[model samples]
Target: MIVLDFVGVGLFAATGALSASRKQLDIIGFVFLAAVAGVGGGTIRDLILGVGIFWVLEPVYIVVCGGTAAVIYFTAHLLESRYRWLLWLDAVALAAYCVFGAYKGLLVTGSPVVAVVVGTLTGTLGGILRDALANEPSILLRREIYVTAALLGALAFVLSDAIGLPQPFSACAGFVVAIVIRGSALALGLPLPTYRSRPGREHGAIR
Candidate 1:
């Protein structure tokens, strides 16, 4: 499970750098983004529980963030297409973190609400931090259903637990909810609603 976390850590750092790169941010921006993206969720969790941060004892956290930033800095041109694959990759990482968070929360705190909230933070804080750094509109802040999707996925996983499903199967079901939500968003261009636009200011109104 730590291995999976590392993979997600690396991927999310990579994703953050990709977002930074797309915004044409500098190297400092990349490192900052990576650092924030790497530790954002853990930081939030620790803070909420009134515990000291987790990464302080784990140098691997710094190494991963720094290494991911370096890779992005030197290989920016090679990954110009990152934006194209960002959504799917983000979904994959999101699913991994959600399962891991829920598992840990349930094991440690044994509270379903804690499990769900931690799972959400674990799944989303990195992207939220990334958006904050980029000054790009957050996927969460927009009129989209980003956090809603994650919460529903977590709910599904919790339901699976109540039904006595295998942990792995439950995790997969939760992951599927996230993937389906994200994929459908991608395929159908789903987004939040907005007020009416003037005739000349029309922007493909959905409602």
Candidate 2:
């Protein structure tokens, strides 16, 4: 679990740095964005669970974020498409975080519902914060299977554990489910159906 957390944080930090690169931000900005994107979701999850923030408890996570920023700062320009890198990295982080976040929530709260919610939040919030900070389109606003993928990942983990699956297996299953869904969305341009009002009833009177 610790390894999973570190992997997710590092990838999220990379996405943050990539966003900063797109904006041509300075090193300080890169670090700032990386820190937020790396720890934002976990921080919220810890607070909601009434536990110490993971990165605050172990400052190495912050160092990881900083190191990722520095590396991307030097290498981001080499990428032919930073946006593509950001999307794929964020997808991987989302998958890892969703499973781990659900695991944490189930450990701390013993509620599958809360686990699912926390998992989704943990998976998506970091990228949301990063995009907002970078003045990019919010992932939540997209029609793609972003939040749904996270939610399903969390559900998969919780369900697998409930059925007596080993923790490691459960986590892996969840990650696979999430990544497959998100990757399909990215590669196939798959989108969720959107609301469409009737032609003349777009502004129907409210009750």
Each prediction's number of clashing residue pairs: 0, 0
Give per-residue CA lDDT, model 2, range 148-170, as digits (tens): 89999999999999999999999
Models 1 onward score TM values of: 0.81, 0.94
Cα lDDT for residue 172, candidate 2: 92
Residue-wise lDDT of candidate 1 within 73-174, one digit each (tens)? Answer: 888787547775565666777766766666667767778898888878888888888888788778676555577566767777877887899987887887
Off by over 4 Å in 2: 198-207
* lDDT of predicted model 2: 0.93
Residue 160 in model 2: lDDT: 99
Clashing pairs in 1: none
Which regions in candidate 1 have their CA more than 4 angstroms from the true location?
192-207
- The most accurate candidate by lDDT is 2
